[model samples]
Target: MTEPATRVIVVTVFVIGALTGCSRRDRGQREVIQNKGSDTLVNVAQAWAEKYKEVDPTVAVAVTGGGSGTGISALL
Candidate 1:
């Protein structure tokens, strides 16, 4: 993989890991990670979410795509 892509992935994973440690689920709530955008990434995102469930079933990652613009808008 390219250096930039690897860097981005690493950063994303780090963020996710950090989030896992501090979640609302322990207080009787669901832990959710919203992943939006990138049609090309939707497949991989879904796969990652499914596999992550095995690794950490307490957290749920909801992945969806509606073009990059849609995602950015949603974030706003």
Candidate 2:
């Protein structure tokens, strides 16, 4: 409703949509996108991941949350 809330939703949607294209696969392996971060975003992220699976059944989106610290560590 608020401008900032709308912005966050838009950005989150864009990032998730972008990530669908970034999934990596190995020989004979299925595609997976690991989305981890922000406890505040956990519910929304999980919902998106589920919906995305419906759109593209070939790829799996794994969403996890443990705050930004955990996400940063996972990234490195």
Candidate 3:
């Protein structure tokens, strides 16, 4: 496949893995996954969050865009 398609596939797989890993917890309580990153990825992140909901309705994915620096700082 083309480079762009490959990149998309890789990212999709990574996101799915992350969401699934985070979802593995108490099913009785609602869980929220915070995804914060580049502004350019805001739309893509939101799309992933929406799709992930179908996979696990008990978990809510919250996405916010504030650039790479801000995203990294949040990890600290």
Candidate 4:
């Protein structure tokens, strides 16, 4: 093929490949859910967060425990 034709084909292929491989995730909409709860419930909360993230990678779940008051404050 001619150099011009070859270059056009190469450019087209590259553009198509790049577009197809791109992921459309809205970083601005990404959120991290922070939870603070009783130490006993902390494990359960963490497990729920992990499962949630598996289904929604854009949502981050973080869990911390400092007692009942802390849990309530976290929600507020």
Candidate 5:
């Protein structure tokens, strides 16, 4: 094969490989699930967050414990 043909093939393969590895998921798009309340509930909230991350690696769940009032304020 000619040098130009070989170069074209190489470039094509590189482009295809790069695109195949690229994720269509928007990096900027994030799902935030906030859990707040008693410290006793913190463990359960963390567990849920971990499971969620397994399903949607991009999602971020923040768990804070300062009582229900604090949680509600944070939401606002």
Candidate 6:
């Protein structure tokens, strides 16, 4: 397959995996924002989460990073 096609497949798999994971979550009391992907973005995401928390204490933000594969598998 061509490179772009392969990338599209991978991204499609990732989005499907993410969506499936979302469906299984509980309807908890708190508002939650789940950000899981790319170890490289961990610090940046965390920083944003921290600031966001200060702005809105009622909402919850989760920032986790273990690598691209790890992030995707989290959706499983």
Can you write out model 2's per-residue Cα lDDT over 6-66, one digit (the tens) per residue?
A: 9999999999999997866676777889999899999999999999999999899999999
Scored by lDDT, the top model is 2
* Candidate 4: tens digits of C-alpha lDDT, residues 1-76: 9999999999999999989958766768777778877988999999999999889988899899889988888778
The residue ranges of model 5 lying beyond 4 angstroms of the native Cα positions read 1-27
Off by over 4 Å in 1: 1-25
| lDDT digits (tens) for residues 15-39 of candidate 1 | 9998896844457677889999889
Model 2, residue 33: distance off in Å is 0.2
lDDT of model 4, residue 63: 90
- In angstroms, the error of model 3 at 14 is 25
lDDT of 3 by residue, 37-71 (tens): 79999999999999999999888999999999979
Clashing pairs in 6: none
TM-scores of all models?
0.63, 0.62, 0.63, 0.57, 0.53, 0.55
Better of 5 and 6 by lDDT: 6
When summed lDDT is taken over every stretch of 10 residues in candidate 6, the lowest stretch is: 21-30
Extract clashing residue pairs from model 1: none
- Each prediction's whole-model lDDT (CA): 0.90, 0.93, 0.91, 0.88, 0.84, 0.90
lDDT of 4 at 25: 61
lDDT score of residue 14 within candidate 5? 96
Scored against the true structure, residue 4 in model 4 reaches a CA lDDT of 100
Error of 3 at 40 (Å): 0.9
Q: Go through the candidates in order and give the clash count of each.
A: 0, 0, 0, 0, 0, 0
Candidate 2 residue spans exceeding 4 A from truth: 1-28
Instruction: Please give the TM-score that candidate 6 achieves against the real structure.
Output: 0.55
